[model samples]
Target: MILTLIAYALLAGLALIVYLSWSFSPRLTVGVAGLLSLFLAHGAWKIFRKPTKGRGYRALAAATTAGFTLTAATAVFVLFYGAGCGCM
Candidate 1:
């Protein structure tokens, strides 16, 4: 469980670094973001499944902290930062 969380954190870090090179490497940025999201989802699932309950809660707390940065950084790109970025 802890290993999964650590892997997620590492991917999150890579995504942040990739975000800095956005204009020059948009595809890489997207790739890293996708990886981070995958790991987070996997970790969350593992944490949820464990028999020990608080471990999941604690992991969720940590994930939320890590996820805040991801959302803040990528919201502009993925969440329709503008009013009409083709969304309905």
Candidate 2:
């Protein structure tokens, strides 16, 4: 329960930081998001590999998976459009 809440809070904090950085430097934001996507991909892989224990674990896994997907999408988008944005 508490652990899940903490995980969610940390995830939200990371996303919020990345989002807020966009206005300052889109390239920097994309770089950070790319790094975070890698980290979260590893986390999601580890979580999915483990056996299910409880609802909290499953919920955390789902949240991590979603975060990973979003960050990855953001990183990929930057790769396609970053050169034209003047931030690259």
Candidate 3:
């Protein structure tokens, strides 16, 4: 559970760094963030499933996975549709 939280925090920190250091374009920002989120979500699932003495870790992992999955989906939507809008 703690590890899941720390991983998410690290992901957020990395995203912030990318957003600040890289281009402000949605294609780059959202693409990187989305990919990272997907990877983290998978990692979280693995951590949850790994045999461990503590059963309490599942709750955090489940919640984190769901949140990351949602974020990834939204990022995909933005990359495909939101960023391509002709409004600009």
Candidate 4:
């Protein structure tokens, strides 16, 4: 319960930060977001692979999976459009 709330709050914070930096280079945006996501992904992986009867574990796992999927799709978008947007 508390964990889910915190994760969501952090997720929203991340989204806001990314939105605020919209003018940043796309590759930089992707890199920073990807770097940040590494921790989230790791946590999610642990939660999914080893369930310790934690509260809201299922919700957290779902959120993490969705986050990863969206991130991956964004990467694909960047790969396709990044060069046009001045990414080196």
Candidate 5:
């Protein structure tokens, strides 16, 4: 389904961002994670903006939003919790 593809694409995009960031600066991994988290949240928002007439699509959208929310929260925690401590 289209929604599934969109969700996968978002996941792939986040993974690519993480990979690129890690390759470029291992020291800034937390910052990159936070950025990717924001991106995921944005993707989730976009997904929610689409109108879904079926229960399945609604459920999928909810799951995607929840996953993105968790990622964003974890990223923020990692960013602030690892600041200046070099605990990446």
Candidate 6:
């Protein structure tokens, strides 16, 4: 658990930063948030377990999955309380 704790702390810190950034400066906040979200999604996809496949195919699948996940997450986040609320 030290790793898990660190991970949770990091995610919490990121969420806090995102919230503050969104409240103070929406444009820059959105850009940063989007990039961060993409990075997280990509990383998660890369680590996901799946059947073995060619490198190119695996990369493509991961990217596609990440894109979908990000889209859905963004939608939920926006729908629950506008983008400004940062209610994650």
The numbered model that scores best in lDDT is 2
Q: Worst 10-residue stretch by lDDT in candidate 1?
A: 79-88
lDDT of each: 0.59, 0.66, 0.63, 0.63, 0.65, 0.64
Q: What is the TM-score (0 to 1) of candidate 3?
A: 0.36
- The sequence of per-residue lDDT tens digits that candidate 3 reaches over residues 1-88 is 5544554555568668877857667678778778777767775675467567856666656767777667667556444544433532
State the lDDT at 5 in candidate 3: 52
How displaced is residue 2 in candidate 6, in Å? 14
Clashing pairs in 4: none
Residue lDDT tens for model 1, 1-88: 5544554555568667766779778888788878877766755554466466454356655675467556555554433333232433
- Please provide TM-scores, in order, for all candidate models, with all chains considered together: 0.36, 0.40, 0.36, 0.40, 0.39, 0.37
As for candidate 5, its clashing pairs are none
- Model 6 regions more than 4 Å off: 1-16, 49-88
Cα lDDT for residue 78, candidate 1: 35
Error of 4 at 17 (Å): 4.9
**lDDT-best of 5 and 6:** 5
Candidate scoring better on TM-score of 3 and 4: 4
Instruction: Report how far off residue 35 is in candidate 6 (Å).
Output: 0.4
Model 6 lDDT-worst window of ten = 79-88
lDDT of 1 at 52: 62
Specify the poorest-scoring 10-residue window by lDDT in model 5: 79-88
Candidate 3: list runs displaced more than 4 Å.
1-57, 86-88
Tell me how candidate 4 scores on lDDT: 0.63
